[model samples]
Target: MTMTKKHLDSARRTLELEILALQEQLGQLDHQFDQACDLLLGLTGRVIVTGMGKSGHIGNKIAATLASTGTPAFFMHPGEASHGDLGMVTRQDAVLALSNSGETQEVTSLLPLLKRLGIPIISITGAPYSTLAREATLHLNASISREACPLNLAPTSSTTATLALGDALAIALLEARGFGPDDFALSHPGGSLGRRLLLRVADIMHQDQQVPRVLPQASLREALLEITRTGLGFTCVTNEQNQLLGVFTDGDLRRVLDLSLDLHQTRVDQVMTPEGKRVYPEQLAAEAVHVMEENKISALPVVNQQQQLVGALNMHDLLKAGVI
Candidate 1:
């Protein structure tokens, strides 16, 4: 069945209400937020995030963000904690407890153990006077004026407020820990941004015999043979001293054929692109990718400080390395 206009309009209205509610809830961030960050930043062990239901889902994501950003945190279900996961929380650890009404039976059940361990507790709650907040070492008021549901019961605005507060706490702790992109990338090594930031050009480029190159005085046939044998789709034309002189590629050969030139009689220097794009060996493979895209080229020759050919990389190399 197709969706009706009423369905889309209802969803949009809910989202709009949630956005405004979140904006209103943001005003609740105050001195308690700063003090809570101080407690988390001083932690030597992990941050134990515990919540119930929807709050548990948001807490899981918050814990991931906190861990990735260098805060060293993990989410432990309070219900599970009561059943023996409490062993995961050391005295050095800090706890982040979430409950919209400031009193979830599963979460409140852990307060005694948390107090016994002497672990600091940061409570994210709407009711500052509730049991959870009253027992917390640092109480962050995430109180929202109302839920986005017209009936004012479903967790819409309250969840948004909780999520925003969680993000603020994670980011604050990240800044306090002096976290940088490299630190962040270390934890997200499988992502593209991590690969781009952590991987070196030498890690992906064709190093020795795989590099396609030919002497400038070589015949067009010789260069074409090197390009085909290496499967780089291009060959670097270098002087006898191995200094790059030009580059010969399928595109250059296309232009050369248009001249109706004699391949057997032609030196690669005569038909190669004299001003073809080049990259330094020390440059990042990501930068080379950018250069290739900008110039609309498929391959680039890696040069040394002395402008001597050192390596050869192609778009295919990047593709094989999962970089492009």
Candidate 2:
């Protein structure tokens, strides 16, 4: 084979080997997985993940995924734990230790201390009968037939299986604990997912005087002034009780002009869109975007349980608020 063809062959072989390793893990999901989930779910404190070398790298990512998904976890390096970081692990927490051979010295050395603390231990190891697995409260088998490396000395396929197993544990615990997108969003407040799930219409809408509104009996000229003053592109038409009747927008103005109707002689109610689409203050801002996209309308009036106007928002407001 040419040099370029040789490189392509190696890449494909590596991926195929990793794929087979993950496929092997699928059938190994058994009762031990359930016990692992149960142990994590019952914990009042965080899930502490610890490992050495490549295993440690995978453990850090696993902890991050767990924390962001609502499981509440952090990674602890085994070498650090041996030094003084052992103080961070409490009896209320569960320890997830990763070691492909189950004989990693830095990790195994901390086992006796973990046992003395009465803390539960969960092991992710390739060797089911290794020392770490035997010492664990529960063991998850992340065994693969061989490493993707041609020499089978590097930690390639083994680390991938370990990472996948960790993800499986985190997701299972997330579902069992009734964790939802809103809960996940709270933990990730600075992210776009959080904005989509937690941002509400009340948080972004213009209220009170900022809302352009006119009485149903008002002339079209008066309503136009309200829309211009508030710059919301539309004005709400309400009755004396402040209940919404309809909306009049720039589009309505254009259509009326096309008909050669006298703007000064028109009543606001005569051309307003009565019972137009409305949203509640408590609805998600993302939902507001969905409504706007579906209706091809730029603005929506907010009403409360009593059907009285409380606020107003448009596509521009949502875009500026990052809900779009």
What is the Cα-based lDDT of residue 70 in candidate 2?
81
lDDT of 2 by residue, 1-324 (tens): 899999999999999999999999998889999999988888999999999999999999999999988888999999989789998988899999999999999999999998998999999999999999999999999999999999999999999999999989888888887898788778878867778889999999999999999998788889889999999999999999999999999999888889888778889899999889999999999999999999999999999988899999999998888887
TM-score of 2: 0.90
Model 1, span 1-324: residue lDDT tens: 347887888889888887886787667778888888887777788898999999999899899888888888899998888788998889999999999898899999899978987889999888889999999998988887778888999888888888888888888888888898678768988967777767667788887899899998888888878988999899998888889888999998888889988877899998888957888866767888999999999989988888888898888888777677
Error of 2 at 45 (Å): 3.1
Q: How accurate is candidate 2 locally (lDDT)?
A: 0.93
Worst 10 residues of 2 by lDDT: 185-194
TM-score of candidate 1 versus the correct structure, residues matched by position: 0.87
Model 2 segments beyond 4 Å from truth? 1-13
Best model per TM-score? 2
Best-fitting candidate, scored by lDDT: 2
Candidate 1, poorest ten consecutive residues by summed lDDT: 191-200
Q: Which residues of candidate 1, in runs, are more than 4 Å off?
A: 1-3, 176-178, 191-198, 274-276, 280-284, 304-306
